[model samples]
Target: MNSSSDSDFFDVIVCGSGPAGLSASLAAVQSGARTLLLERLPGLGTKLLASGGGRCNFSNLLPEPEFMAAFGRNGRFMTDALRTGGLVFIRSFLRSEGIETVAEDGFHCFPSTGRAASIRDAFLHAAQKRGLTVKTSARADEIRIREGAVEGVRTAIGAFSCRKFILATGGTAMPALGGTSKGLLLAEAVGHRITPPLPAMAPIPVDDPWVSELAGVSLPDARLSFTAGRLRGSCRGELLFTHEGLSGPAALSLSGPAGRAWTEHRDSFRLILEPEAETDRKIWCERIDDARKKEPDKLFRSVPGRTMPRSLAARLAALAGLEDRRNRELKNADRDRAASLFAGIPLTVSRLSPMEKAMAMSGGVVLTEVNPKTMESRLVKGLFFAGEVLDLTGPCGGYNIQFAIASGRLAGENHTGTLPLEKQG
Candidate 1:
């Protein structure tokens, strides 16, 4: 990267040094545009460093549709980026940079070195080698516009002029990583409408004694369903019981629906731990009967223990009022009660963890106002946006980072028309 004392003006100015800003600046510089990247933090990619619990699931190899579905309805906006060689380009770019990638679980990709710093270093080195200037500890407070056109940016350091500007400032997710409303604020200043951001992909706080009681217990896969009047949704993944409530991939995925059910319909959420195909309440009864005929002294808790943790099994038996009851002594009514509880347990959701605890925020810069193909703002000339600043969010497993990198490259490549656009039929 260029030194902090480098020149103030450039052909393109990228604000924020996360994945998007880094990709944007690198693209601009490679296209022979004089580019400058400004980062508010002393270091770069703080949030990226913290992604995937610090291991950093940088990208994924999921087919486009499955990848897009993770972001829900707003996912359609990614069509141009994904189809116009964005994902392929990123994979190729990383390989060319000598940064090896490894795919886990047949989809999620991470640095072979298992360090987020590797990705950050690769980007910073490439940008600097391509003659990109850099400024750390510099904040872009405002976009300087005049006569209904582009100009420069007002930053903590000073005003830097640019023919074109790209805003990759990100949303309010993790304050420790420097996520804030700066980019949203700048977009609004240019007359762009911003959808209010809400926390997405975070843990849900449930008001149940058992949730805390079962803290630290985890289920590899569980089905989570929520119902409140007209709203209903379900997600399946690993579930982790926390001191406060639920976490892990399944809980994070279900948080959105749970939030909606509580906010819109005022309903409680439910979880089906290790859900079974047999739901007639006879399956569990028969299993208990068979075990009783063999052992003749098996406890009721042993049935649930086969599929769940021993502590959770004991807790469920207690909740069903058969904690001390033996399998042989369990009446038909007792078996039915335990069967229902195991099928789907009810849990009261008080609220979701605050935005500061979320992995990503769900809303920003209305998608329609920006060109998906070019990552440029339709409302403002010579303006572009990318990353979490957009109105899109994806589930766990590297989808979010993939979008950020792809969108960043699009914004970088198209910000100044240096990289030619594809011919449309």
Candidate 2:
């Protein structure tokens, strides 16, 4: 990377150094454009270093549209960006950086070394090799605009002018990683509309204190459905019981919508746990009856352990008021109650965890304020945006990072008036 002492004006200035910002800087430099990457922290990719449990699920190997579905409501917003710079482009970019990747579960793509720092180092190395200036410990205080166009940026060090500016500052997730709402604030100052940010992929707090008792307990191969009044959606994945509440793939996917619905309707919601097949409920009942007949002294909790986790079985039995009842002595009322409890476990959501603890943040600069084709700001010339700063967020498992890289590459390539692949080294 270019030394901090260099005072030369750059053709492009990229703020933030996460995946989006780093990708943009690298793309700009590869296009033979003099580039400057500004990072507030002393180091780069702080959030990327923490992603995927520090392994960095870089992208998904599935088809583009199918992968876009994971974004829920705002999936379409990324179509143009992805079309210009998709998984193929990302894999090739990593390959050029000497970071080989392998796909797992037909979705997640990770470095061959299975390390997050490898991916970060690849981008940092590529940017440095291309003569991109990286300024660490340099925070962008404000965007300097002139005549409705980009002029330069005011940093902690001093004012630096540039021909083109790209704001790749990430959203407000993991504030400890240097995420601030400043990106939105900066966009708003330039006449861009800002969506109200909300926490996505976060754990939901359950009202039951018993949930904390089952901390560290995990339920694999289970489906969780969330319902608030009438709106309902189901997500099937592994569920993890945490000391705070429910988390894991299933819980995190539903957390955003559940949190929003719970806010509008504060009463309660239903989280149906369809562990067994719906059609097999009758057969399950028959099996339970046969077991009861054979083991008269056995408790109801003991029987459910065969099908469910021990902690979950005990919790369900307790909820049905059959904790102390012997299997053979269970009445029709008790049997029906147990079935109801098993089918649909009621988890009263108290609140969503803080944004700092979320996997991703929903909401950012409104789509209407940016040109979808080029990812350039409609209000400011020579200025672009990509990544979490945009009003789009996807589910866990590499979707967010995929879009960040795609959009970053698109913005960077377009900034220099060239296609992504054509500009690549």
Candidate 3:
């Protein structure tokens, strides 16, 4: 915080310079508030510059309903925000700023330049053009609350008063990528409940020795089913086996709840990996049976299917004690065991990968305490929240970023403590 700013106070102050913070600052400025954006890092969007392997999956093409559902039970909290600044708005906004986006796979959107720096630079250039005062390396140490409302913020350098403040400090995932808990701490000091921040959108490490051997193996599509707290379900998408465990859309989508359930419950849960939507024990059994009559001399492992990775098939076959046997040599029990292994391989996750490896976190300021319509705290007037700092975690794609932009915009635009009158459509 610069004590030498022409004024030490502003109408709106947004903390953290990630996607949410940048968006909040822009929206506040546009809403006619004298706004200031603060960043703890040396510059803006350090984490965002590293998102999507630097490609920056900014948003997606999912419609409102399906987009909201991707976030599970608490997704509805973002209804207003999403409506205010969903994909259409985001894409148009980027285009207005000379940044074109493309949904390369017809879903996950990326900047046409394929560089996250382009997106970050767009925000930087726009902020400069709009005269939104942004101070870097200014970590908010304390959020000063007057009575029951927000008053100002104090950093090690200086204290800047504000009529309202927004917390977009993001989550504790990828600490190296500008992730920290300062925003959560500040919220806690001012009477906000914070969920235990857990790693999400990252790989889950397992102790299965055979899984480790299939490090480079990729499944066409994989399904990971688990029960974690209120998020009990399955995630289906592409999957890749790693030296430690599973990584890819499927594993990453389920990692959040699975990790939380494993640590919180103090019990190891089964991580079921089904290779495809139609795959089941019966299908595997039939495949094996057909192979016995058509190619009886072939190895049992080769009977899994043409899509199954050779190494993974062999490993699963070995687990069923059928690796070295011919398809014709499989007895009923052997065939059943092989079918089960092929259908859904149960892998034991020793532990979820650390926060340093995660794309985002599962926990944050619980959604209940904040008003979804305005992104404002129900407990504290003039205090608002956006982005990963809230208890909203999406799968490994463009969902989280889209929420950040939308929620940040809502929080910033509504900093005056009221919703904007929706124009008659």
- Tell me each candidate's RMSD, in Å, in order: 4.1, 3.7, 3.9
lDDT for model 2 comes to 0.80
56-170, model 1: which lDDT tens digit per residue?
8977887888788777767878887675435677667777889778886777788887888887778888888988888888888888877766688888888888767889988
- Comparing 1 with 2 on lDDT, the higher-scoring candidate is 2
Candidate 3 accuracy as lDDT: 0.83
Give one digit per residue, the lDDT tens place, for model 3 in 1-425: 34346347777889988889888888887776777888888878998888888999988888888888988878898999998878888888889998889987898999999999888778767766776888888888998888888888897557888868899999999988888988899889888899998899989898889888889889877788875444466889888989888898888888887877877764545678787757788988888888989998998888764667777777777888876999889888888888887777777766679999888999999889999989989998889999999998888788998899999989889544433322111
Clashes of each: 0, 0, 0
| C-alpha lDDT values of all predictions | 0.78, 0.80, 0.83
Flag regions of model 2 displaced more than 4 Å.
1-8, 104-106, 229-231, 264-297, 415-425
User: If ranked by lDDT, best first, what sequence of candidates would result?
Assistant: 3, 2, 1
Mark the 10 consecutive residues where model 1 has the least summed lDDT.
Answer: 416-425
Model 2 scores worst on lDDT over the 10 consecutive residues at 416-425
Q: lDDT tens string, model 2, 4-114?
A: 553557778899999899888887888888788998888889999988888899887778777787776567778888986788887787898787888767668988888
After superposition, which runs of candidate 1 have C-alpha atoms over 4 Å from their true positions?
1-8, 84-86, 267-296, 415-425
Candidate topping TM-score: 3
Model 1, residue 324: C-alpha shift (Å): 2.5
